[model samples]
Target chain A: MKQQSKARAHTNIALIKYWGKRDNKLFLPMNSSLSLTLDAFYSETSVELSDSFEADSFILNDQPQNSQETAKISHFLDLFRQTAGIKTAAKVVSQNFVPTAAGLASSASAFAALGAAMNHATGLNLDLAELSTYVRRGSGSATRSVYGGFVEWQMGTTSADSLAVEIDDASWDIGMITVAVNTNKKTLSSRDGMKLTVETSAFYPAWLESAAKDLVSIKEAIHKQDFQQLGEITESNGMKMHGTMLGATPPFSYWEALTVEVLTKIREIRRQGWQCYFTMDAGPNVKILCRYSDAEAIQKLLTTAFPDNPVIISKVGSGVKLI
Target chain B: MKQQSKARAHTNIALIKYWGKRDNKLFLPMNSSLSLTLDAFYSETSVELSDSFEADSFILNDQPQNSQETAKISHFLDLFRQTAGIKTAAKVVSQNFVPTAAGLASSASAFAALGAAMNHATGLNLDLAELSTYVRRGSGSATRSVYGGFVEWQMGTTSADSLAVEIDDASWDIGMITVAVNTNKKTLSSRDGMKLTVETSAFYPAWLESAAKDLVSIKEAIHKQDFQQLGEITESNGMKMHGTMLGATPPFSYWEALTVEVLTKIREIRRQGWQCYFTMDAGPNVKILCRYSDAEAIQKLLTTAFPDNPVIISKVGSGVKLI
Candidate 1:
């Protein structure tokens, strides 16, 4: 049995947010989405299959995980074992530089790295396509982290089809400025939020129907390398997701005053003819998509305006790698 | 002309929110909405037409208003003169206990009172139906203030048909708890916001399609005096309006952090077997609908939790009246 195998992967921000689950068991999305793999946040993980190990043991960020987290990792390892045709127990350890469960897509990198490491440890050597599906079954968004730069998550009906595919290396002068609007833990988990939104939002059906059309336009924009078209659609798509959340039962909002403040400034910059726009995930943070040349300027303005908030500039990062 | 006339009217909270304009000039809504007139906030105005007046001079709260405010009132008065066949300028004095243009429906009471006072001053003797049309020409929601307690604004196709009709006097045990989340002036006018949403939101057409169905269900709920049904629909309707805003071209939200805090608290209370629900207007504040019996307890909780916020308990209020 392999002693150990390791891999690293970066998190990706959805330019077009994937809000709800169509099929929870397979982590199938209600609609297709697009994302950009980021350079800043990442996770590194190692997995070993050996008779010395009594059972599947997991550690994250230097701390032994609780039963729930351990069980989840164990279940994922079982899937890997089934594919590899091995009964050996595994010891898995992961380190995350990114904030976990704070809407920063930490799980994407974590699971993507896990998928790659397991493949390597078992000597299965699955390609990105198989690895993407494996990562998706663990976390829906982790599928996108399997590839670098710009990727598209297709809302396929079956387990085999619903996986992310690379659109571009994002070699164009495109970058993002991320503002840490709120790094605090969210009150509602994304899984629970998706469930609530799907069950209660009156506009969920409309959102589901419109996402395919948005995906089509966004893909064309990517192919054409049209920055304006991409930025406009990206911003609209994010807003549509939040709008659906607002229609949830009892209603809720992830936005803070600072989020709006950052958005207002982004618009001010855009009004000056800069190709700058913003997209927010389930958290209060705002990610501004702009030309690489303009990213520093936008970040500087935001830092000057809100010195308390950390501002980060990220480029197109590399794909998951076995190390 | 009659020497002088005076009237008072209360502000109304839309359980079913009014958003977007079908015809900006006529102040027509694209979808029907429902509202409850509240006793906590109102406007009192007195108008006098005399030969000594050279033009329409207006004083609000013992202070002269700017030309913009003057122009809006003057313009509304012109419509009244055209109907009465009189060309006399008028001196108008107004007092607003409600916050003006801050999403508290000050315009509803202002225009409803103006409509009644003007009709009386000119001896036109327009009834509630005719007066609703007149008030709507000034402010779309003012038509609802023409009637008392609970009101429904039908999204009629033309100027004459798009008028408010009384649903009931709200004699049942019902009330709302007001949370002053952001009493500051809004950055965008509701009129401008409505125009932008109507023009840009992809989900807007869906909203328009579903509004009539919501109206029917809410009306049935009202007739049955089913608090749960009415509360659920009201909460859903408000969320849908905000969701539409999120789909706007640049996208915007009327929520602040405290707004979410209040909503979270409301949901917590609801889970404890209470029939409390919330709705927000064009600003950050939230109005919670609850049984009159539960209003005080809810208000106390909010007041204790958010010491800086003003929490008020309100009951169903009367319609426009000559004073």
Candidate 2:
């Protein structure tokens, strides 16, 4: 086996949104979700393919990987190896570029970069669709990291077709300001929350049924370069995801004091006629999607409102590539 | 002024379930729910002509009614007067005969009987449908008490047709055993819970879409006397309702220790091949629906299992009527 090269990848935030899954094992979703890859926040990973080890090894930010953390990674590697007809093991060394404890999409960058690096090492020369399928097996949202600018993870019937595809290059006026509310990991993981929604929530079907329509509308809105349409749909989708969590049998909430604060500030800013909108994942941290020109003013207002917490601003970024 | 006559009423438990309101003023539901009215538990009431006050007065179980509790009843009485073309107001005296903290359908009986007796006193000669419509304006479930034995409150688009109608007389081998858990009023009222579900739950539409199918299946199961089918569907429906509560924005739970205990015991009993099924309402108490012959055995087991608490058993009961 040839010595593997090291690489880095940045995380992306969903603009349309992906919530529930079609297949848990493969991390296949029921509907497509579009996202914008940012240049600033990312994860740096080094993958070395070796024959000495029996199984794959993962080290995140210089820490040794535990069984739980490596489970999804191991599965992804196994799929890639089986597809390539290779029996050798691999070692993954990864570091998140985002601030420690920051509730950001670090996994997106990690899996996306890992998928790209692993493919390069094996010389599979897999297409973007094939690479996305591998990454999705690791994390549902990771598929979006296969491309930079504007990307959409098309939720096809099977994992084979459910790969990330680039939409617009996003070389336009769009920018994102990530307000780091809390650096700590969230109480509810999106994977678990989505599973619970699928298993117990009576409202899961409604989300599944309407998601395609939402995606279509969001795509049209994005094409028109309308911030209001994008913001409204994004906010609605976020609410819908949270709604499913609330409907679980035991009921789980992905909200904190900071979540409320962020929402309040976002609404206040919006009421002031700012072209800024906020979207959150499974954590309290919020990423405001707005025009490049409005990003500075919005960031200023947010910093003033939350004097203690610092917000990170970045322009739309590119997808996985050789560094 | 004439002396008030003593009368009693019983509340019915809706099996099909009612949700969503078309008209807040009329308290009309979007769909009909089926319910059973029990005979052993009821609410007794009496009314008298009073010229000493400008408005009607109410006393519940020897306690003076507060303005908040009287508002709905007062409004209903006003509507009744307008519908019947009555001239004067009357004083209402009510007493509930059902065990107060047993989570029994006391309010159903109380309101149904009140509506019936009030109608009798008014010399309106209104049928059960008219009575149900009048009472439903006060409490949605109260409309089901106008008929006996598997009554369904048809959620007609109009109030005139949205009345409770009898489906079966329940003269078959059916019996119900209610295991008293905690009799305390729920912290989250159904009205508030429903409102929360409507406003916040992302899965609400999904539940709404599938409810009709569930109602149909349960109705068929009941007609076929398939205990397994009935039990399964009933449990699913109950779980769905509870799931919606959990999915509320803030999320709330209804399961108590006793709820768990009763469910455990029911599962244990079911293991022994007794065709017993459990159903619960807004409270922690559980009502077990089973064959008439198994009632005594079920009662004995429940009593022995829960020695600290009282377990009451009752056969299929009749609807509201004059003695």
DockQ, per-model, please?
Answer: 0.52, 0.11
**Steric clash pairs (candidate 1):** none
lDDT of 2 at B307: 87
Task: Supply candidate 1's per-residue lDDT for B290.
Answer: 93
Worst 10 residues of 1 chain A by lDDT: A97-106
Model 1: per-residue Cα lDDT over A1-323, one tens digit each? 64689999999999888999888888988888889998889999999889888888899999998879998988887787898889898889999978642337589999999999998898888889778888898899999999999999887878888888899998899898888877877887889888998987767887887777888889899999999999988998888888988777757777776777778788888887788889988878889899888888888888898898888888888799988
Tens digit per residue, CA lDDT, model 1, B1-323: 43799999888999887888878888888888899999888899999998778889889889998889999999999988999899898999999988532336588888988888988998888888878888898898898988777899988888888888899888899998888887777888888888888888877887776667778989999999999999988888888888889878778877776777778788878888888998888888889999988898888877888888888888888999999
Off by over 4 Å in 1: A1-4, A51-54, A64-68, A99-103, A181-184, A256-276, A291-310, B1-3, B49-57, B63-71, B85-89, B99-105, B265-276, B291-297
Q: Alpha-carbon error at B305 in model 2, in Å?
A: 8.8
- In terms of TM-score, the best-performing candidate is 1
Candidate 1, residue A97: lDDT:
75
TM-scores of the models, in the order given: 0.90, 0.64
Per-residue C-alpha lDDT of model 2 across residues A34-129, encoded as one tens digit per residue: 998898888777778888777788898899989887876777777778878997888888888977645686778888888888887777768877
Native A-B interface contacts kept, per candidate: 0.65, 0.16
